[model samples]
Target: MCGIVGFSGKESKEILKRMNDEIFHRGPDEEGFYQDKYVNLASRRLSIIDVLSGKQPIHNETKSIWLVWNGEIYNFKELRNELLKKGHKFYTDHSDSETIVHLYEEYGIDFINKINGMFAIALWDSKNKELILIRDRMGQKPLFYSFVNNEIIFSSEIKGILKYPYYKKEPNFEALNHYFTFKNIPAPFTPFKNIYSLFPGEVLIFDVEKKKKKQFKYWEIDFLKTNNDNIEEITYNIRNLLEDSVKKRMISDVPIGAYLSGGLDSSSVVSIMSKYSNSKIKTFSLGYTTFLEHKNQDIIAARKISNILDTDHYEYFMSPQELIDDLPNVLRSFDAPFSGAISTFFLTKLISKHVKVALSGDGADELFGSYLAPRLSQPLYYFEKIYKKIKSGYQLSNEDKIKLKPFENNIKFLENLYLKSNGNFEKWKYEILLFKDEEKKRLLNNGVFEYDKFNSFDLLKKDVENLKALDPLNRALELEWKTLLPDHVLAFVDFLSMVHSVEVRSPFLDYRLVEYVASLPGNLKIKNGNIKDILKKSLKGILPDKIINRKKEGFVLPVFWWLKNELKSFIFENLNEHELKNSVFNYEYVKFLLDSYYNNKENDFKLAAKIWNIVSFKIWWDLYFK
Candidate 1:
């Protein structure tokens, strides 16, 4: 619930303040600063815990180690007791962040192993002449950093880093290529050149005196290693771990609520939350207008759960015009390129009005299994089978390649299957990218080098290679944890919520819970074509039977309907060929997407998604780069 910014080279109080001010919405309650010869650190505090004297950059008892942190350490009180036993004294009454510097003092860089929470920490060790930056094991918080003239500048968002006078303004074209492919850039790559996001479970140690840096991983989730086999026992353990995670996340001093989307994940979170709360838990859901009297089953399910739990619940339907109006604000909130724009934008704006902290079921799908993956796996497997045979003596004929080219944009899932058949890792990173390899070849101006291997998926090929021993389901889940969850889902949630100073906590993403679930056999996660089978079975008695059996529907906007009707003119105005003729996209390809949508193509949803990607990219480009 705060924004942290600092520099290790030049000391500029003005730059530090400007950097912190860029993300003022992240911490509107108060702001603090700590300047020294080699470091300038600042924090915008949201006043979540120890509202009175809990401020940053908080110093250790010796005053040599200073800390500025963004996140909630749920186990701070317990860790504090352990530190107290070791003869450590604290100044503030109940500041969760106070334990970090003391723990670092006791354990050095190994302190991260002993703590469990979502945090991005900048700990300045003046005595060692080193600055240490750490991101949580789950990557719930984001940290962006750049090295300029032997100095390292770090901040909670990219905008903060941009405030530095020496920061580079060049766009990373490789990153833009990946953005178009994955709808978001994968980790360690930002849209701007020379600026990078820290990977989850990564620890960065910078030597201020020597002007050197070392980065290494402290934690990772390994799905190749399976643990329990007893389905009943494993199910029991999962429930226990999830309940404990929810309890831990409810440690805030302010009002908290749950996002009950009527999906199994969010509903299960609300159920567990109700068990722990004596008062009615506030729940929220989102719905939209449908012309054909299409019943919103998610809203119906949400109402049923809220009524059963007897909680204060709220629902809102978003109009296309409302979303169109807020598009600019949504575009500005992202620190990097992203595509989970519409739903998250409206959902966060609605929920922030009711509570300061909200718990969500964000990681359940990635940790367990998603329907889309399994549905496409068979096609991919069959294609790979044929591909291996064909490659033995037959390569893709030019005519066949051309036939497949059109389908790439029309059915990304099928194109992904085809890509996998050819031993390409691109599909693993984004099973359905905005554009395929061949399309991007035509789209780019042919100026960038190594365009073939520029995808974020290629960067993570080692991860896929490492997990070759695991079942396909588990392998897909592991890849998602490394790519989709951190870069897109968590970033979207963090940006939208922080825009309104609302902190979103995901119990499903707790490292312990994630690891435990990952260790379970993939068969339990998905069985007989059913996704999240174990999760659904586990919730049998706890939730209403109807809710448990509900069909899986994504939390997405009705963009297909809106684009052809409500927002048709808007898309035409913003995404015409004239505007994009001088840009990176191929004018014909862009025209094809819009023309197909307008003409009501066979794959209408695919066409709509393509349109959305183009519109989103154009809007973001105009706002930040233009």
Candidate 2:
């Protein structure tokens, strides 16, 4: 795991070094470079697999294809054997970076499909005179690039791109509007006007001589259902696939551990790891010093599971002051405005103390229909059907009435939304999105309105009607797999974990496991209103009922309580009207959000999310733009 940064022009090497220095935390072990007239590539090395001689930019035997990549190629050993059989020679003892150049030489760009790992790669093809930038199938690693000043600047983090001599700080107002909808700006768009984030599974090939570029998506989960409908068989296959994924991600030369939150996803991964390893597995978790409304059951549950699995365990309790002190670094980590799970920064900091690499159960919820959006998708589908029936003069059945009982307020909210919004409200998007376009009109200042003609709804509206063949639940899940997982959750995870120079690998994010989960019937995933029904069933015997049946409490924080007490002054101080009047938001709307939540008792967590997104954006804007 490392951070890669460089440009493709005859600028001073000092600028490249400055860009590389920005991400020293990503690769503190060493730094390597490949500078030439056509392109200059640099990597900050974390030294995961082959520490001594694995320094990159690893090149082909002819030195024609030089590669600087960030991530672990879990199947590099197997790939190396295949390459060796074909008469490919390697320079390092057993480095994944070396395997990449050899594979590119043999199979060309198709090698990306053959490799199984999380990575963001920048390869200079000297013979072809092109710079190839690739992001992994899951966006476990980040890659940002820009076309400016007759060159292309790319980096593992956007801060590296900012170190360029001629780069300006114009805001992507379209992305700022979209940022209000999600915790982070969705990919293909960043907060910068010129710079862009490469979408997951996307590859950008740039011709250095011509200064032209082309991008293609090599992988995507279609959420296409397979005809395999046997629940028992599907569950059995899930277990096997998860076990194999866990074993593959455990390939590391340095000390490794697992982030055990005691939820089903983490517990399942930890239990499987213990079975595969001969020694005690190291597990890490975190909790709060105290909570008012929110619960901190994760520490308690993690301790119980550690005893049950007989593993070495570590736990940390965080004070509010620590979070406040590190808030600036947290905002800086994501490289944009972000609002969810700031406490994860602390968890990764704790894990980095004991291990160089840590395995997490991050992708399971996004893969299975377990998140709040997916949970609502099932009932919302039924509600929409029932509403259409009533509009057509059909009488509702007792079963239909029973289902609607739990969602009466949800129905009213959508009804109010219809009169307020531009036109329609999709099942899950309207409810789950942090803020709608309609709300943006009232919340954003005239500056955002003046910088118009861009559609914020595009984020939610992409491919909605096109995937009509799949069930409503599957469609919602697939949209999240595309947007929420990669753009928001995984991006946040990668940035925060890499801050402490710790590598976070997720077994659930393995593309093989993702493809299999996508193939199964959607009903099996969220059956009878139960989220991840299939996953919980598959682990019935392996995990005790207490663990399996536990509610999903991810590295959660007490945002609602903090807003009222601990972080109250910090929120208002950072969200200064002086800052808001000059920025994109309306100061009145901002004050209304704060006063309603903090003073007038509108204490819904959703409102708190809105307040934080705006506040976080202000902090980020002040840091970068000022």
Provide the lDDT at 6 for model 1. Answer: 90
lDDT tens digits by residue: candidate 2, 51-101: 988998899899999999899998999999999999999989999999999
* Cα error, candidate 2, residue 73 (Å): 0.9
How well does model 2 score by local distance difference test? 0.83
RMSD of each: 5.4, 2.6
lDDT of 2 at 319: 78
Q: What is the lDDT of residue 278 in candidate 1?
A: 78
The models' CA-based lDDT, in order, is 0.80, 0.83
Q: Can you write out model 1's per-residue Cα lDDT over 487-548, one digit (the tens) per residue?
A: 98888888877898889999998888888888887667766456688888777788888888
Question: Which segments of model 1 are wrong by more than 4 Å?
Answer: 290-295, 378-431, 445-457, 460-463, 466-469, 601-603
Colliding pairs, model 1: none
lDDT of 1 at 61: 95
